[model samples]
Target: MKKKIGLYFGTFNPIHVGHLIIANHMVEFSDLEEVWFVVTPHNPFKKKSTLLDDYHRYDMVYEATKEYPKLKPSNIEFKLPQPNYTINTLVHLEEKYPNKYDFALIMGRDNLKSLHKWKNYEVILENYSIYVYPRITEVENIAVLKNHPKIVEVDAPIMEISSTFIRKQIKAGKNIKPLLPLTVWEYLDKMNFYR
Candidate 1:
């Protein structure tokens, strides 16, 4: 049987507890055998100025997930062309891993609402399953997708915690240690990041 893997793509500027919670919940409660944190080098919609170096962000994800057997850090997007889309990564992963892995997308409710705007979104919907976690956001215009057969809503906790908020707290010299895993926090502190 192919290993079931869920792709949790993000910048992971400084991976924190909220991310762990969601990823863990997905693996524990769903059919996914493992959750891979696919760190993106560049996201088409996000600005580059605020993003830390790709390696540093990847390192943080590595540190954060090292303790969890089912959680992993993947820098596959780093070697791909800039402004990589989810479809491109999904395709690449399928080819690279061959028939060894069944890949699915792990996303939040907010992203679900905007899935229609993604590149080749229809293709994605037809080819892969999506596991969505709840988010406290104004969801709109996703009725068509909400009932899609491939989309599964996981009863995971609503994690409003964001990397941006953690960054701000670090910049303000506030104690943000509790938000991150110990190894991740140590790496960020040692590098003096976000300040």
Candidate 2:
């Protein structure tokens, strides 16, 4: 049997409780054997200026996930070319691993609406499965994905937390402790990150 692995791709500017929650639930509640946090050095859709260094973000993800055996981080994109795109990452991973594992792209519900805009979006849909978790807001046109055989809408906790929000709160000297993992928060505090 092919091992089922879900790719939870994100920049993870600073991995927080919300990200961990979603990833943990993705493994526990879904068919995924494990969920890997694919830390992209640069996301095409988001502005690059606001992103923290890739190594910093990767370290934080590693720090946050240290307690969860099934949850892990991947710096695969760091080895790839700049401005990493999901379709390219998937293609390379498939080629490298071949039949070793079944790779599925895990995404947030909001991404569904802009799926077409991603590079080679159709190829991604055809070749690999996609598992979407609900966001704080209702997913746009979720009913339209009902007929997609490879796309699955998973039941996950709707989290209001976001790295951007946390960053802003930190800059304002607000306490974001509640939204962050203790280890992650401690690491950020020690490093004086996001100041």
The numbered model that scores best in TM-score is: 1
Candidate 1 TM-score to native: 0.98
Write down the lDDT that model 2 would get: 0.89
Compose the digit string of candidate 1's lDDT tens values, residues 9-105.
9999888999999999999999999999999899899999999999999989988988899999999999888889999999999999999999999
Cα error, candidate 1, residue 43 (Å):
0.7
Hey, what RMSD does candidate 1 come out at?
0.9
Off by over 4 Å in 2: 142-144
Q: How would you encode candidate 2's per-residue C-alpha lDDT over 1-195 as one tens digit per residue?
A: 999999999988788899999999999999998999999998877899998888988888998988898998899899998887898888889898989999998999888988888888888889889999988777557565667998988999999888999999998999999888888888889989888
Model 1 spans > 4 angstroms off:
138-141
* Residue 97 shift from truth in candidate 2, angstroms: 1.4
lDDT against the true structure, each candidate: 0.93, 0.89
Write down the TM-score of every candidate: 0.98, 0.95
